[model samples]
Target chain A: MEGALMATEERSAKSDHADSSTGMLELRDIVKRFEKPGQGEILVLDEVDLDVEAGAFVSLLGPSGCGKTTLMNVISGLIEPDRGTMRRGGRDVSPDDLSLGYIFQEPRLLNWKTVRGNIEFALEARDVPEGEWDGRIDRYLDMVNLGDEHDNYPTRLSGGMKQRVSIARALAIEPEIMLMDEPFSSLDEITARDLREELLDIWKREEKTIVFVTHDINEAVFLSDYIYMMNTDGEMFARREVDIDRPRQYDDPDIAKREAELYREFHEHVVD
Target chain B: MDRLTRYLYTVASIIALLALWYVGGVTLPEVIPGLPETYAALVVVLTTPGPYGNMFYFHVWKTIEMLFASLFVSMIAGTVLGVALGRNETLESTLATWIYAWLAIPSLVIVFVSAIWIGFDASSGYFAIPLVITPFVGLNMWEGTRNLDTDLAEMAEFFGAGRIQTFKDVVVPQLAPFLFASFRSGLSIGWKITLLVEAFLLTRGVGFMFRRYFDQYDLPTMMSWLIIFVVFLIVVEYGVLAPLHERVMEWRPEAEGVRVTE
Candidate 1:
């Protein structure tokens, strides 16, 4: 435990020295269109723009049909923009230059593999050295509080537990940026709250850029450093930086105030 | 369900079969031999070497060899062909329908043509078995291939997975259940085609003994041979395929506990 704490301390010290003013990811004029079967083309992301600072947690807060997921897909380069320029460190670069870890609304695990094997699948895809695999799996699974359940299959896991495994799988790759698409929206309230705190704790220890997509106002207020509110027309019309302090609580007075302000802003613009 | 419940179901089926056999013996003695008489005939066939101057174990060994060899050959060929056809749209549209056309052509015609054209040998049975069973195996594989989850592929691609890793980890496991199902059914049909080829063309085999038995009107001996062979096949299918299905599909729900297989 002391050794792990020391390693984490060393990591945070190095990250603190690095640049934080510029966003790790910057998107401008990103537009994506999907063709309806019987009808014509419909714009899913209409010149959407976003910026995610290095070592900071950002939330894309929006209601349904607001293209929150489509924007996330554009940021991850899964869907090519009909017209846009995506840049890393304020310069355009190829996807090969950056590795991304994605957490879908569903766990999206390989049910045929054990929890350990699932993470190993990601590590192998990232081409982590074969010898370093065991330590990485142990650390990440332990971080997710799933060290003991590594041998279990996803089929036998509860919904919350499976989602935890997916989190571990993504973190195992140690990607440059973590992309989550409504990751906790499907879980029960208690599980979601618990995972939110766990995620915050991990974020504190290892400062990686995270772009979380959610429709829940409370979730956005609790987890993100900055919240970008998008409307149903796929336009990001508002942005806010939560002024509350860290180690936030479910019932913190400051959190409630931030949540109330966020809700008011969300209702004014995001609701259809 | 536990092991005992599964074992009991199998035992119950065997008892029902034995009861039916006893009734058939009493009602039609000349046609269906009694259990005791059949057992005695089986003992004779197993222990002795002389039946129309042919050794029983020799023929049994030959037929058993044919059964497995054909299945092994067909399984490899069919699975590879299925995966290929399933992944390629042009190949599927052009030749998938024609592949099943092999099934509609009777095994008898193929045997007669082979006899008239190439004459008789082990090669004839080997060719005939895979020809009869490949389409069934291939069809299941094609359907499984079509259902390959592209969402999972997108996830893998996002993770920077290479082509080989995607095929091994993602593609292969999804096709496993379909492959196992087709393999079992292939065994059932492939062995029959083996028998057809053996009886019509080959001279010194169990199929030849079957031909000789029919000629001499040896009902007890014929029934004994069939009963023993079928029992042998039942052991193989259950012992090998059932356990294999359990291992491959162990990640599935209720995989360990008893669920209704049928």
Candidate 2:
């Protein structure tokens, strides 16, 4: 696993240098507000800027209600920011133009659909070629280690299995950018740890840009190549690069050190 | 406690109620007919041909036809209109009061007014029955559609599902339980309203036969028809609606404690 991680890093480093453009996903001067009942408009996102390089795993780490999910929603085009411009592949693009996939905090699988049915639904919606559907569904399901659970309904699956199906569903679309909002927050620690490893493996193989939102410091440290620490007021307060070697263990000293440093940084930010 | 015990209890209760009714009728013949007399009267009605020729067959058929026709029309029209109202906030607000008013108005009044306008004919019953049932269905569907999972909806849209696709895949599945609830209730209410309309209009149905018996003072025959109609309703409720409900809700995890036994 360690050797494979090193090889992936070497390849990613070379590819990162090959692309000279700004980023695969670029947000400039993004602002958003919400209307409170008694109070007037409250600013949620204040002139936030972010750039995600192609095939990079980035985490937006913040406390609860820190607008991390809101930022994701804006990026996914589920909610439009009041003012902002988003660029993909160095060209201004709407959410509709980008082939985007989203894995919400909850496994929002259609209860009436089987695992295969859910994947097919996404494929159909994305207008994937009918001939390619079976191959894509089978391949992605196997990627998530759920090849045999194709006929099972969501209600029959455990929490971890359901989240895996969700991952498979998102990957089946072959999206350029995948927006995940705390996808594993609801799972038990053991299950979450396993999924995080599986996710890192998938990310290395798929080579897709992922913008993950979570409040867990260890999670952000474990998964991200770059962690953007967000303040409670929705501002990007700090950016840290995890220079440690990959195939990182949960109890690895380096990861624990980084996790402690992030915790301190978060507390200091709150104090500020 | 268990399935057999539950069935036994249900049977015991029914038998106890029948015993009480039989004793009451035998003691006070003026008010109620005994069980034996009612059964004899039912046999007579089943076998004998009235002025209309086989009153049981013809009238029962007409009632069933009207009941189902109204239910079918109301289900389609009500669902469409309800979905529209639920989706459009401005339209819902503008017409909410009118929907409430329609619900407030009695079915008897609607039947009478419809008969006055369209005349006391078979057509009037058909028209009035849909009008009576549509509002209930429409209102239930409106609430159901309004309360749909917006998160799922946003997810569908984010994944590039168009409006029609979202409605079919996300919206309709969530509304299934509500739709079935409305349908079952609407059917139950719809048949009763059909009978009332038929009675008032003196048209060709079980209601007309019931009215005919009332005028002739044939108490036993009238009671017999009532019993048969109630049995028919029970059959439709359990045999048709229950099975359909079970099928639609089969995806839901079974409740821990509930059990059904035949």
- B152: Cα error in model 2, Å: 0.7
lDDT of 1 at B199: 77
lDDT per residue as tens, model 2, B1-262: 7899999998999999889989988999888878888889999989878555776888888898999999999998889878889989999999899999999999999999998999988888889999989999999899998998878887788788888888788888899988898888888899889889878786677888788888998878888889888889889878988898888776665667332210
Off by over 4 Å in 2: A1-23, B1-14, B50-53, B256-262
lDDT for residue B232 in candidate 1, whole number 0-100 = 78
Q: Which stretches of candidate 1 lie over 4 Å from their true place?
A: A1-23, A252-272, B5-16, B50-54, B99-117, B255-262
Question: Per-candidate DockQ versus the true complex?
Answer: 0.36, 0.40
lDDT of 1 at B247: 91
- Chain A, candidate 1, TM-score of 0.89
- Per-residue lDDT of model 2, residues A1-272, tens digit only: 11111112222442364254534677877889999899898887877777777778889988898889989988888889999899866689887877678999999999888889899889988889999999999999999988888887787788898889899999999987889999999999998989999998999888788999999999999898878777777677676777678888888899999999989977877555
True contacts kept of each: 0.63, 0.44
